[model samples]
Target: MTVGTAGDPVDRSRTVGAVGERRLIVELTRAATADDPSTTADAHDIVIGSGDDAAVIDTAGPAVISTDTAVQGRHFRLDWSDARTVGARAVVQSAADIAAMGGRTTGIVVSIACPSDTTVGTVLDLNAGIVAAAHGLGGRVLGGDLVDADQVVLTVTTLGALDGAEPIVVGGARPGDVLAVTGNMLGASAAGLALLIDAERRGDVELLRRHARLVDAHLLPAPDLGQGPIAARAGAHAMTDISDGLVEELITMAAASGTRLAITSDRIPVGDEIRSAAAALDTDLRDWTVAGGEDHELLAAFPPHAVPSGWTRIGEVLEGTGVLVDGRPAGGLRGWQSFGG
Candidate 1:
């Protein structure tokens, strides 16, 4: 696949093969570090960075680790997102997993496999984005690998520190715990995706202009990185991020906890942007709010009286087997099934 838009006179025209692996590594390291020591220094000690064989991190207690991968055609498209944004998304999504376990990101390692013909500028942009995202969460890219492949692929492994808090898992919810979410901007990403897809097919300039925020949500999702730890501290019984849609997460939690999660349809704070998009597309608002994915908001079960601030209480847990919406079985779009389509 084409790495970046061509016909430029600078680095975009310089292919990775032309730069050679040694020079490419040096450039990528420079981009990742950004020549700033403050950004790289954090509570998690780093003994060695990119120059070493492997990253050496000094940490206390068990580390919260998670790995997420993004591919050229499968996870992202150059036409939809720039190389930097793609890299940022990869780090954010992977870091969210650590947050779900009641930890904060401390370090990141990224691996990229792309065709030799890929532009060096694109890879550098991707590295820059990864560094920015990691630094934003008090983390840094320690080291990684680069190699030739048929398509552009990125795999990010994140390490997190939980401090003194216990790691929140999926099977901890009790019957009386209430369900809560982190942000009010639920479903906006799905709405934005719908608008983007529609624009590609039919070109709706007015729609794009009116719902630009939603489009931004789809492309640059800002997951509440701190809320996961907050929820854990506030006595959350079970927790997970809404990566595969709210309903899907609810089902996973329910099955894991062996309880039923009943969320009211209206209790979820769906914004006007999502509502407008649903109306324009002639689709049910629940499809976006309930079944949409990639918001990356924290979903947790807390005691009714212990629901923390910054979290909207949406439902209650009951002794049952699966998820329910308004006392009925959740039907229709179950959410993004990776192998389904």
Candidate 2:
């Protein structure tokens, strides 16, 4: 039975019951990808669907591959987000990696692990997220695996085709290249995290609405996946997705190219929401824009004359090493270290 529909209500009259993996997968596929009406130009080569031991995918051009794994309590909180959100996030992060390589997403293989006591409805809801995210990218869920574990885990692998375009790598920028950023870097997710930690400490009802927006960003970030290929088409010399903090990723680019990244103080993308939130929380806005990770914005180094249509120029690539913000040394914080603890 479907869940979360307006009229077709779920039979939740009984307590949540454990369902076996194969049956849970059947229900999840029925609700998520099987009935999806989404179509994309890139997803036509799928010869088979899920439930098979192996999936067959054909690629016309250079195939690009990327994978991401999200585990409960590490990547997300069960209390903060639903299964749908978790599933969608899994696909988004993987798709962003493909886009960062200047390729179009063609297919996705999702593998999920959950506790034996997990409800069938939970997996179904997660499938909804996985399907929605893939559809948004004009891609499809080719196949996946379902297994039993102690906690919810999703390991998503994405395949893409370059369509004859040059695969952009990490170290091609030259001196005097202009550094540009695509998408909002307003630290909405970071602010949302802060608000969630201290939400009950405040009585500002009006602020709660705004708080939810930031919290939602933290829980389910929607990166501008389209900006990547756009940057590539516009002749981006080097590119990297901002999965880490802005400056942290820039440090990577600088180290790769053996150059210096000089960002201006006024150029980092900080909007009114971030500014006001920082003031309210007594936190430096720069810390979030420069050091906070998981914004997933795309950063590219372009020739000064051609910076693309929608990208914002935030800095320049100079002949040196390390990153310099307003001519001073920065990027001291190690951004988003997984397995650090």
Candidate 3:
């Protein structure tokens, strides 16, 4: 039986949904590719959009490139996170690496793998998320590949330009350099996960929202994109993104620079959200603050009195190797490893 004419209500709805998704993808693609006119020339030389297997980009100067992956079960769960959020997370985290290098993100290439059962709607939403994140960083997705797999996985590679700035390598730190951070630490994503695990648990839903920022932070972390350039402008000695636990990343920097780092527990910033969540979980907020991964904040070292505004001093570079928390070895798990428990 005909509910209406050939162009009936159901048909109209389906058409609208399809159009909306297409529009969303176009808008996202535009946003992702939009860049400063001056920078556009640089990106244009490398990109072959409109038709290509992978977008081409000119890797002039010391082009900073970084890649990151997000897996369904380990990095996200479909039951908890929507596809849009998952897509954005993939772009954000990868871009953060470029920002940490005191470089500007110019382009991205994303590879997505998903099960056949994944909905077309979900795939569009994921694309929207990726476009939004790339836009936020003043970069664009040049091209990528899609494939079928047992699980959903997104791998993103970000390309950046140093713009004549000195690459802030992890090895530049020296004794007497001051260690500092550009953003909050610990427990946002962890807290959100706790709530998702048991929604009935006594935690504020608003806190959950804040914790979801970690989802974005973990997935779509807005690294202080401008801060990297600012740090470089201010003569940052050394810098690295705090993707691994703060302590573990510090140890890595220390080793790279052939210096020791000592951080005081009292100096690390612990947010109330993290503190309260830690209490509820019977975990130490300090541990998460120091050892948690995926914060994506920039940890950097500067010569004494050379720090910039918006950065807080957390420790100092010492004359040896290894990292110390309040003058002792950080004895817990050193940091996060992709294959390690």
* Model 1 score (lDDT): 0.83
**Clashing residue pairs, backbone N/CA/C < 3 A, model 3:** 46-56, 46-57, 46-58, 89-219, 89-220
Could you tell me which residue pairs clash in candidate 2? none
Candidate 1: regions farther than 4 A off: 1-12, 35-44, 331-341
Candidates by lDDT, descending order: 1, 2, 3
Model 1 poorest ten-residue lDDT run? 1-10
Model 3 lDDT tens row, 1-341: 00111221222223223443333334334434453232544445454641244566775677999999999999887766788888888887888788888988877877777775666567667877887777677776676665668888999999888888888988899999999988764435544555455444664465456455544444445557678877887888899887776887887888889998888867776667667667766766665676676777788999888899878899999897777886667543453232123
Q: Candidate 2 on 227-304: residue-level lDDT in tens?
A: 878888888899888777777888889988999888885887767787777787897777677777677778889999
For every model in order, what is the number of clashing pairs? 0, 0, 5
CA displacement after TM-score superposition, residue 339 of candidate 2 (Å) = 22
Which is the better candidate, 1 or 2, if ranked by lDDT? 1
Q: Give the range where candidate 2 is weakest over 10 consecutive residues by summed lDDT.
A: 1-10
Q: How far is candidate 3 from the true structure (C-alpha RMSD, Å)?
A: 6.7
Off by over 4 Å in 2: 1-17, 37-43, 200-207, 331-341
